[model samples]
Target: MSASIPQDVFSAEWLALREELDARSRSHRLTGLAVDWLDKRSAGAPYGIVDLGCGSGSNLGFLASRLPGPQRWRLVDHDAQLLVHARRRGALLRDRAGSRVALETHCRSLSPMDRELLADADLVVASALFDLMSRSWVESLVAACAGHGQALLLTLSVDGDWAFLDRHGARVEESEDIAVRTLFQTHQHRDKGLGPALGGEGPAVLASILLAAGFWVESDATPWHLTAGDATQRGLAEALVTGWHDAAIEETPTQAARLGAWRDRRLADIDAGELGVTVGHRDLFAWPAERG
Candidate 1:
């Protein structure tokens, strides 16, 4: 949410770094519900799915094979470069029925989200995206999907809970850590190309909206547990710390020195294989009540 922070967090490198973690953090329970709902649909026709902010098609990759085939996907994102990667990956996927999936990419902003986006989509999905959206935007989306009786699976919405853990998997709490986290959370509520962002309150707000709209909703925690022992996880942990530090500094410039020192200590602990990070996220699956 830092105005100075480059908006390129969606860069291919960053997306790639977090892809595996995202996949593992997704709730199997919510995914299973989504699969069951999709499977119950009439067969022989392609299942039309629209993925909002589909970065490099990670959601498509995670869900395509698990879902029923003859599948047709529309991967949408503002980043043309990320869409390119998504389209390329989509070409290689086959559905649960072993049929090649049909795919298309849309390089467009999700702001002013319209019913047209949900018009042909039987299921609308997005991953790690709702946290960056405003409440009004989400309401518009739920209304659109409900109007079409479309199911929704929104994944990896940060629930604002995170902790640095010690070797024994216990939280390592520090005053500065708390301070940095608070500032980072404040930064999260700032505009992110889409009005004021929902930040950590996304999942709960979305669920409430869905319920009010008469859709059945289910949500589960899908947290990332990164330990320093694994090379890949260690890298992600470091990146997370740096990103948090930058955001915190941007939110409170006066505390830049303190935040920097805190970041350095966290990074050092991570490097020494003495730290682990747990980031809480939520995965939600909602469908029109009539469908349930």
Candidate 2:
């Protein structure tokens, strides 16, 4: 999986393609719960956030705008290049409330960090990240937050449910599509610097881990509902299809020819503006069961 990945998997183009989709797809219901928790936890004081696997700071820009008041964020990621982009974008974040914000970048992996990394944070969050983690990594994260009395928000985790809709709104049923998707999900579960990833099972696994650690967890489905009419959605759809095709072929070389044909068909659908794609994801928020 690592060898086949692009050096800039989280590039600016890719990030832009999915940002609005992520904004629209994220569960506002779960976000409301997170805001309530943030409100209560911050209690009119400054809010500090620690963003794990922060990527190019799209999460920082998105959350900073919605979350209220003065805020401080520590964006952590292993990619120095992404951290630079994140820092630059994070500095430009503006909110409707004209909220003030301070930003810092940490070029390090979250797994090996001490609990102190989250110690003074009011919230610990990550976007499109939990699915890349192992059970032990998530457990450590849950323990750190629970131990430190911090609220958690994790979003945009894939759940192994995806479908393509035709012009008639009927589900696109191609055998190669199913086979490729299965293979891609299998690749998703391989180690991604954290141990064997949880892949599509991420949300459920995280909920279970946090709940067992004595935290109250709330979750909501946040599927990317893509339509080819919009340019941004079209870009996202194209990129997603390309990514899935590449990963699928990489994982199952025997099926490359069949998957290539399937890829060509999906690309044609996108170009013809008749493709509708739904990629399943879940958003989660957790706080100590008993808040002080």
Candidate 3:
């Protein structure tokens, strides 16, 4: 993994693990609006889209066939290896009209807010990325998009809500779980190569900024509800438990023993097929108010 990749979450393993879940969890309604917004643009040329943090091109894979045809995509990420995966997968994408999509990749950091990157884009799209960005970065991005009259679609931004649930769909809470959660949330705000990350607050903050910028924004819940009975989701649940435990320990080393116990219990529950995990996320689609 490149040093610039935040939290090591952009690795091919992690991207592959979450890709299907992300596709299933994203709000189709919001995506439909984005497609409609893009369709309304002048039809003489292909639509230009830029996917920030384009991990393995999962965003492109999900949105390509859903959006209108003759599309050009610029996949941006700091990890060159991931960019290679993105480009390979992106080459196989076709738009709604069954036309081959134009694709390019840029391996660079997103900090410092590159205005020129958005200069030619008709739409700016990102998935599972905003939570790692500070408020200022988001504000800068929205301002640039607004200046260019570009549409924006962002998906799977963590809303800072999650829970371990019983097979009956009831919440399973413990005191240590709450403590661990608080610590993990705090850890989320730590600088992830993007100054202070917004973490779960990212979606709401971005929505507010878009609204303030005279954009008509539509948003919906896109939470991941994973079951222990399914093998893949069970694995993801285990990973979440391990990740949360590690993050909580990083935030409060004094509680390492307690958090470790909590992690063990969570893994045990998963192994016994007694619990599931629900991670909250939100998807937003915004366009210039004039278009509304």
Question: TM-score of every model?
Answer: 0.96, 0.92, 0.96
Stretches of candidate 3 above 4 Å error? 1-7
The clash tally of candidate 2 reads 0
Q: For model 1, what is the C-alpha lDDT against the true structure?
A: 0.85
Better of 2 and 3 by lDDT: 3
C-alpha RMSD in Å of predicted model 1 compared with the true structure: 2.1
Clashes of each: 0, 0, 0
Candidate 3 on 152-178: residue-level lDDT in tens? Answer: 999899887778888887787878888
The TM-score measured for candidate 2 stands at 0.92
The Cα RMSD of model 3 versus the native structure comes to 2.2
Ordered from best to worst TM-score, the candidate numbers read: 3, 1, 2
lDDT of 2 at 153: 87
Query: What is the C-alpha lDDT profile of model 1 across 62-126, one tens digit per residue?
Result: 99999887899988888898888888898899999888999888788999886777777889999
Error (Å) of candidate 3 at residue 60 is 0.4
